[model samples]
Target: MQDFVAGARSAFLRLASHSASDSARSLWADPSGVRGVLRHRLAGPTSAIAFCVLLGAAALGVGNAAVFLGLAGFVAAQVLIARVLQHLGHRLRPDVGFRVVVVTWPIALGALGAAGWTAVNDYHGEVVSLIGLITAGLVALVEPTGFAIVWAVVAAAAVTTGAAVGGSVTGEALVSTGAIAVGAAFGERLRHVIEAFLGNRRELLEETARIPASRDPFQTAERLLQPLVRWTPVKNPSLVWFTPDGRSVFLAVAGNNLPPHLAAGRELPEARNAYMRRQAEQGPWTSGWTVVDGDEGYTRGVASLGIQAGAYVPLVHEGRLLGLLTAGWSAAGGDHSAMAEYIPALVEVAHAAATALGPGLAELEQRSTASQVVDDVLHGQRYWPVYQPIRRLRDSTLVGFEALTRFDAPVTTQRLFIQAGLVGRLRDLEIATMRAAVMEARHLPEDCWLSANASPGLLVDTDLLASILEPIRQPVIIELSEHEVITDYKPIAAALGRLGPRRSLAVDDAGAGFASLRHILEVRPAHVKLDLGLVQGVATDLTRTALVAGFVRFAHDAEFELVAEGIETQEDLDALTRLGVGLGQGYLLGRPERASAAASNENAPRGGRAMGASRVRSRTARTRSQAGAIAASRTTTPAH
Candidate 1:
């Protein structure tokens, strides 16, 4: 019950903020709306004053009996005092002019005693009347809805006392005054109750009316932006996409049509800040693309005087240039600097458009470019994988050949296909490379293995990883580049999860950039490659020597097998051997070549490992011509 009352009161308060006095349909009309209003307006002071006047008349009309006269006068005087106080306070009575009236029987009776009435006869009756009024007032105040009830009790006591002793003018007035006061209090309470109910009903209607406008964005935007557009003048605007070479490629105009310069083949100023920012940043760049009207002199044939003035923000995603956002002054009277004001809003729209497009935009672009290349140059002119042997360092015998991918006709460059954010797509290209290498290796010694560098994104796709690995029967190690940012490792772990336990995971660079030794621990790779920078001068530099030694210790504890890469000379091999590195790969061993021809020199002696090497070796074995293979083969080892 209390919760219900509190909820009702809260609803009332919420409605009251707009207008508390207005009339409407009753939400809470328990006492009945009309009755509630009447109770509120005339109930309190009216009832109290009327009761006092009636009681006074009754006291006078009676035969001047001392007891009746005294009791009636006392009651009248108390009511009079209460009425006067209520008027002075000027507060809204819930029912009557005065919401509450306190009739103190003890005080009234004591006054009667001073006026010559005594407990010896009328004194006991006077005492009872005084107690009754006191109890009645307290009860009515607590449960205000029962004010009329308690007032009746007080009135009944007065009339009964008057009738019991003797009929007189004083007795009649007491009865009349008591009845009037009870009615007035109930009336005032009723009026307030009606008013509260009506106020709540009106508010509920207003909120329900606004429900539809919030859901429609176009409607919402119109309603929200109308004030800004009217006060300023610019409304919905155009956005443009840029090519990799910073040319305007596409345009999406939301409201107004685009200027001629924004169309394709339009030249943009290289002196602008937007051009400069993109030029300076090799990855992604952004700045405000600004333009003014002809007042700033024939506005690049794109703007007439006071016609177009807006800002465009460059949008580059995943290191590939995406586009620009354009918004302008809705008003015609703005200066060229108005372009500056539109920058923030333009940037916001740029971000929204970029996020909506998703990550495939860059990959789609690169695929388009790759398709263009293939269509123009044919498949034979494209990239091909060259196999380099990873032989046993101790025996100078071949263990496996690491497949290295390189482009043939691009001629100017021969690197991995990851620059256009297409590393994931390269997994398909990697699988193609592996298929060719394995099919070629079928003619070689039966025990020979193959190690190939695969794109890291492939590790997250289990099915893709399976397809890539399924064709190769020999032991295959997929080397991941350390240069790429690996935001998530779980996918890599999951991909490797489906592979054979003998399959190896190798991190190409052991200690460099953000790819610290921690990556080794995180991925728990089977093998780690010492970067060429670290391996180049390990024999000469003590610092490099110490660094490698420390890494070797960590590898041993973690159970990771280490490979010192880029060993160009016997001295490099000798240094790695002393440092307890078992395997080495570099120019001094054998340059990357075609798989079949590269394997023909399997038994030949070399400065490093011989082709087709397979004997396993401990960290202590370094020089070629030992019994075991140079590449360590372990079921599983600790992460680097």
Candidate 2:
């Protein structure tokens, strides 16, 4: 008995479920179902106006108070129903809201039929029939076919029954029923055309809106396939991107139900070969589904994966193919005729995908090219260092040479370093350049010092600095640029100290900003280089002159050498000399040249005299003494 009861309950639930499903399917059968029609912007206002017209007609013609009240109440109910429909339009999905409208709309029309019957019978009035005709026409124009059919049947029956009972105007009742049916058929056709137009328009707008903002090709392809997969019979939508050389392809993204052999990120050499051959033979692959039973490489592979029908659309921009967009169906064997109508839409989506993927692919190609260039440069050691003369301004004697890197490649030196940094090989490149400069510095004159630029992060590593500088015999000055951010300077100071008495720290690009001042106070280097901005117009600009004067005074009091950079004019050079600036480097003094040429004094400044070797030795000793004094003071100062 328990088994029997359980079986009965199960059967009842299944039946109820099937019934609900069937009802829902029937309600949503039309293209723009009841919900879509009612939620349109004009639906509510049109219905309200019709109801008001009916109320006015009844009030003017009908003498029966109860019938007039019934019409007024009906109009009020319609206004309330319009409000509910408006609310549901926003809060509920179209199909779910269709269920609500199906129940409410039919019952409201049935009540109207009843009111019409009462007026015709009791008051001998014909305004009710006219009002019924107007309502029936409105319903046919906007409501679904099934909904219009139900309303037509109810209204015709009401009119026919009234005529038969009154024993008058049977022919008129017949004519009225036929007119409603005709109006319904015409309106349904019009509704189908309108719905199709609106649907296409909305799809186009959505595609246009989403394509521009997308930067990731894989993500954008996935988004483009979503609506297509949901609305069409296609399954397992996937995108395969070609390599930059167009010699290989990989599955970059996929939707659900993808076959194991076609998993994302997997390379497909056979697919790439087949696509290349077809593209060479034909112009481009058009958008359409075809059966996958052929012996071709891609087709056989797809057929083995259980995809009976497939479509491949080439994502082309500027006559170059970047990728392929594909869709497949497992059960569409021997009959894909049903997919013909969707071909145009599929083509539109493929075009949008191509337009969106162009910029992203171009960016990827550029980065790949940049990375390859850096790799070539590093592997081949295709860069060399040139030395620029740093001269004492009063005597125009070469004090030292600053080592700067130059690349043989087309890219600028600064841009090359920046690119290397982006690829996380900045330190490696810096160390390589430093090693090259150290090797070349052996050719320099014995007395002059060598200054080289090093970032703080690299300079702070004592072990690395020792590996490059320990074997060098000449005086070495390691320059730290003030533009670079250094959270702590103690490590750099300690690194220089560990390199023995030959290594001195110099602050580069001083007077550019506040960071330089902080560097001076903290690092207490042996030399300070003035930024070009302060030195370019120092002879004329009072502000610049004042600033250079202050730096000169600070250098005198601090006992460190102040070098003016970029002294282009005689006036600026004279002004720096008058202001007590001891050293300067610029095009006016000497331009950068090969280390061999610079060591031979081939590129020396005009009217300049080289310092005596003894004098150079004495100045180096004094600079070293001052650096030691500054270090001692910093170490002994309290940390207030």
RMSD of 1: 21.4
lDDT of each: 0.49, 0.62
Model 1 TM-score, all chains together? 0.42
List model 2 lDDT by residue over 533-621, tens digit each. 89988989999999999999999898899988866666777789999999998766665667798898834543233422333343344
Best TM-score goes to which candidate? 2
TM-score for model 2? 0.58
Range of the 10 consecutive residues with the lowest summed lDDT in candidate 1: 631-640
The per-prediction tally of clashing pairs is 66, 0
RMSD of each predicted structure: 21.4, 16.7
What is candidate 1's lDDT per residue for 180-296, written digit by digit as tens?
554444443544553664444344333323323332222332232222233223544444445454454433333345455544334454444365345534422222223554323
